[model samples]
Target: MVIEYSGIVVRSVLTDKREKFYDSKGIGCYMFRIDEAEVVDATMHGSAARFINHSCEPNCYSRVIHVEGHKRIVIFALRRILRGEELTYDYKFPIEEPAAKLPCNCGARRCRRFLN
Candidate 1:
């Protein structure tokens, strides 16, 4: 499926962990803020989002924006994203605000201890 935002067509993703409302596929999940929908909380799952592998030095970054009074998660291309490239973002927030670690197979030169 495709998610239409403004005039942009973003991809949609569905995986096994939709019950949690969001799940990271070693890649990332795009989320829509709670205010976007009545039934969901501050976050809703992006079912068509892709599974881009993780990298310590990532080429993409996730940003939360307020759209139509709703907060939405968008993956921005920090660098050039080639066709067929898997989109990835840094799961680690910051050194002081660290998230739990998950097993990582992302094989980057500077792979983190977890995928988060």
Candidate 2:
């Protein structure tokens, strides 16, 4: 494990409201969804893991693991990453309508062109 994506866990229904609140204040939202009803709000208390960008072909991957009785998000190396290599992972966003798709510039040979 490289680092934990630390943050407060919140109900998924609150994501939209919180994101909008952040947007109104020009605060960038940084969150990792855990499931249909849970998400980690990292905009205010995240680690460097939250700053890692997306890649079509990534060297790291994010996972949710249970420890004791708590859930945590962890970033793990996907392979033998060379020194100084940037850490990244596929966002794996849910598919959306074309008009709402986010453009991807990951530049991988097999790039999907869109993130969703």
Candidate 3:
């Protein structure tokens, strides 16, 4: 595994409130959803892994693991990674309407053009 996507575990319902709070404070928010019921709020408490960007064809991938009865998100290498290479993984964001689509900038040859 490359790293654990660590942060304060929170209920999915509270994410909106927390995001708004961070926005009001002008702090960038970092989050990783574990499922419909939980999310990891990495805005204030996170590691360098939080800064990893998204790629259409990623060298890494994330997986949810249950440890001690609690679920955790872990980033793992999808293949061999060379030293000094930037780590990336697919965000796999849900598809949205054309008006709400987020553009992809990973620059991969197979890039979908849109992140969602």
lDDT of each: 0.49, 0.92, 0.95
75: Cα error in model 3, Å: 0.3
The candidates, ranked best first by TM-score, are: 3, 2, 1
lDDT (Cα, tens digit) per residue for candidate 1, span 1-116: 12221212222332234424444434333333222232122223323343444677777876566779765556678877788777766755324425454666767888876665
Which of the numbered candidates is closest to the native, going by highest lDDT? Answer: 3
Per-residue lDDT of model 3, residues 61-104, tens digit only: 99999999989899999999999999999999998888999999
Candidate 2: lDDT of 34?
89
Q: Give the TM-score of candidate 3.
A: 0.96
Off by over 4 Å in 1: 1-45, 93-100
Worst ten in a row by lDDT for model 2 = 44-53
Q: lDDT at 5 for candidate 2? A: 91
Candidate 1 global TM-score: 0.52
Give one clash count per candidate, in the order shown. Answer: 8, 0, 0
Pairs that collide in candidate 2 are none
Q: Please tell me which model should have the higher lDDT, number 2 or number 3.
A: 3
Give the runs in model 3 whose Cα sits over 4 Å from its true position. none
lDDT of 2 by residue, 52-82 (tens): 9999999999899999988888999999988
> Could you tell me every candidate's TM-score relative to the true structure?
0.52, 0.95, 0.96
